[model samples]
Target: MAAKKASGSGSKAAKTTRAIAIDAPPLDAWSDLIGHDRLIAGLSAAIQQGRLGGSLLFVGPSGVGKTSAAVLLTQTLLCERSSPEQMAPCNTCPACVQVRAGTHPDFIQVSKPDDKTLIPLELLIGPVDARLQEGFCHDVHLRPMQAKRKVAILHDADFLNEEGANCLLKTLEEPPANALIILIGSSEQRQLPTIRSRCQVLRFQAPTGEHGRQLLRKQLQWSATEDDELQVDSVSDEALDAAIELSAGDMHVAIRLVRGGGDKIREALWNQLDAPVPDPVAIARLINGHLDSISKDVPKRRAALRDVFSIAVQHYRRQLRNDAKSGEYDPATHRRLDRTLRTFREIDRSANLGTLVDCYAADLTLATTGDRGAIG
Candidate 1:
């Protein structure tokens, strides 16, 4: 492995601000990795067997506890005290407290800067303009300050540009002793082949069925075992179920959906779905207005729009699936629906939300009636 400089240099001031000295929260417990019992067991067994390696890659959807796993694994590795067999951290220890408070000297976490599109190389290897500064690459090579092991969680591995990835290759390939490097991303394919080959990859899947519902209940803090006890005038078990279905197994998304007027949003979506031709612009404007009324942040509004599109996609998919089951599926209509779904999936934050919504509605209208203008 060779050392190289990552591309797209940042200004000295930018570099200083780009790297956030985060004091990440310590894992509540390894049990918090809900819906992943088998993976947890395997990892615990690996710790017991002393087979844990330096470089581990966790790949999964956005909200599936990949980072949480990284934090827990760090605790297991660096805990001042733990069980002889299972390697569970003793939460009462100073090491555990520091790790929990994100103030651990040996534990470092880095992520893509929210203001930038890509993780700058300067952030990984230190600023290009500086000669004697510690970035992730240089810092990881140093001995631990407080613990026997040093753990670094690279949160936005996918955002690492070619240069940044190359710069970190040597460190990743030949990590320093008593150091653990964890790379997290949405999928294995998003990572460079070089990065993927060097690390032990752990794939995480979405919790579904009973696992999903249980997690939702836990997250929502609903303790009612009986259905009647769970029901409130505004939010109920049915609403929770609807959020779970809409979220498509993504718990973060489900939580967001539930918090952001789950029942009302679902009702509005279904109403639009039943229309002869759903008016996407009107729906988009309505959603935008609602989100703006609550908060002025554009990202918040964009997320709301994405949720709306996701619901639309779910509705069309159900229609297509039902048609197929009944032997009434039309190939042309099916193709159209598939295209509409693709359009929704592809809508990004870069696109104008209102226009994107209009385009989606038009596409659906065209798919159903061959008249794109019908929805407008």
Candidate 2:
């Protein structure tokens, strides 16, 4: 009877694992997309009118669902059984499944090289000696292999250098009849004017308030199902509210805050900051340790740090405002707060974070202790 019970438990475990795999969200999960209703309607109208542009640009702040929209567009274009009226792809169709699996012959995705700072010229066009039959510039002109139309998504368009942008311009100026190109970037200014001029731009904004809360709750619930540590249903409204505010409506940041040991690390960091004589090295090391524990990949680590830094800045900014209104405004304190906010721009740069954090901690200590000469 004991052996029989053991076998039954094993069978139940396998069944549960299978259920999770089957229920995993599809690539074109429309319900998963939030806070871009107007943008979705416009894109849907383009599909219904059969006026989808050859080259499209999606510009917005990070984590605002630009790429998700692009993927949904790709599905609508490639699905074997989707109609214009539905404006959504049938996720089960062979073509849709292939697109979701990222194995569709008609779809291409290009992004910045992990080892390099910018998108290389060869990656956009072809190698100089073999430009005729190589790279996205050449492949894009070819007819679709499976779907009715071909789609090419260029991610991290902000990383395009002059040569890369120039190479992409020729294709942008005169794309093939069957090709659709989508470029995703954080802002329009990041791309060359020549590249920007040739594309139809779509803007995405972050979700706010109740809409933001609903999105956060859905995401956390899904995460809890996937990861055992997350207790989405039991988490208090206050904690969820704090996460939402800290994220500033960025979906990616909110998700990371819930799953990336954010609460624990944040509390510890703040505790150290509130110390009578906070040690800069100790605080920097705390952040560095959490970052190291999260990921070995540079980009992921940088993103996690950005979220943490943003939270810290938000906390101090509130205090600054309160102090100002009470006629206790200190110039040094304001300067330090401004500098911390500015550090958000340097996450993608080559600056030394240890030194940066050391300076930030020193500034905080001076501002609170009224020792303006500490930094000097």
Candidate 3:
């Protein structure tokens, strides 16, 4: 197969350097993949028995191994040396190397661009003028050049809008005999019914218990050897435990807490909430300050604000549990928890960040102080 050309105007060496800089670390071997043992076992068995389906929908929380799993499956299918029954890729082979480098002739991947909220229609089908001359739908139909089959993994499947989904329906319904299509999204509920119905759904849960601890350590670069005790120097054992407890089994959340100084933010939030009379202005300022420190990008700040809300939710829940254990029902605590959850949901829909934060803080304060007037 010929080497893939880099897009845009540049010398070959410059384009190659740009591509290498942006590429994520490749999952070269199954050992490089962490967590989801049971899912891997089932998928491996299906591949070995030749029972794997043509289309698959992977639904899970963000930062889980769905994309990595897709890449691994592609390697297993397109490996030059591994037999179908073996289901193992020789990572050094040309086919495996190309796949890892994301330059494989038979492999295709697409996602919603960072600047755009939805997967554009043109990405699924060609632009109006060219029709099916380009894009994922067009490319997936081509004959495989290297491997016996072609594989296309579409990331951010949650962002596929109605028009884009419709463009993909015919392909999903009558997929090419030699092609595999995989869609990765956060949850099945986020996907449209029509799209979900046409593919095999695989639900992935966040790692928990020992699995969560191990994966957290691995991501943090804190894990030493399999037999050695977990090293703790920069991050204390208590901080690690707190991060694990608050992360809700998501590795990304855990890392953010330990590395991003999210723990400090969490503490500040708790301090504000636990005050005798919580100050809405102070609370809003605290949260906004934390958001600003984390990112200058609006979308990223919005996402981090959601995480802050999640932390508040946990705090109220913990208080409610404490009240329950003490044989005292605090209606105010219950209302605050419910309102915090509602505010959390609203973050995605609301555009005015300043207004949203101020209203949420004011509403939480009112709930705490037994005031009847709470903003929706």
Q: What is the C-alpha lDDT of each candidate?
A: 0.68, 0.70, 0.73
1-376 in candidate 1: lDDT tens per residue? 1222322222232234324443222346777777888888888787789787788899976666777777777777778777525557887788877666666777776777766657877667776565324477766766666788788888879888787888878888999878999999878987999999989898888777667666676655532335433333356667677787776666666766776775676677767666666566766565666566556676776677666655656676777788889989666456545655455334431556666656666665556433333222
Task: Provide the lDDT at 248 for model 2.
Answer: 64
Poorest 10 consecutive residues by lDDT, candidate 1: 1-10
Candidate 2 residue-wise lDDT at 74: 81
Candidate 2, residues 261-288, lDDT tens digits: the string is: 5678778877775565557778778878
Best by lDDT: 3
Cα TM-score per model: 0.78, 0.75, 0.80
Looking at model 3, which ten-residue stretch has the lowest summed lDDT?
6-15
For model 2, name the residue pairs that clash.
Answer: none
On lDDT, the stronger of 2 and 3 is: 3
Candidate 1 C-alpha error for residue 88, in Å: 1.4
Ranking by TM-score: 3, 1, 2
Q: lDDT of candidate 1?
A: 0.68
Q: In model 3, what is the error at residue 317, expressed in angstroms?
A: 4.0
Residue 219 of candidate 3: its Cα lDDT? 64
Return the TM-score for candidate 1, rounded to 2 decimals. Answer: 0.78
Error of 2 at 193 (Å): 3.5
**Runs in model 2 lying further than 4 Å from the true structure:** 1-32, 221-227, 264-286, 289-300, 316-338, 341-345, 350-356, 359-376
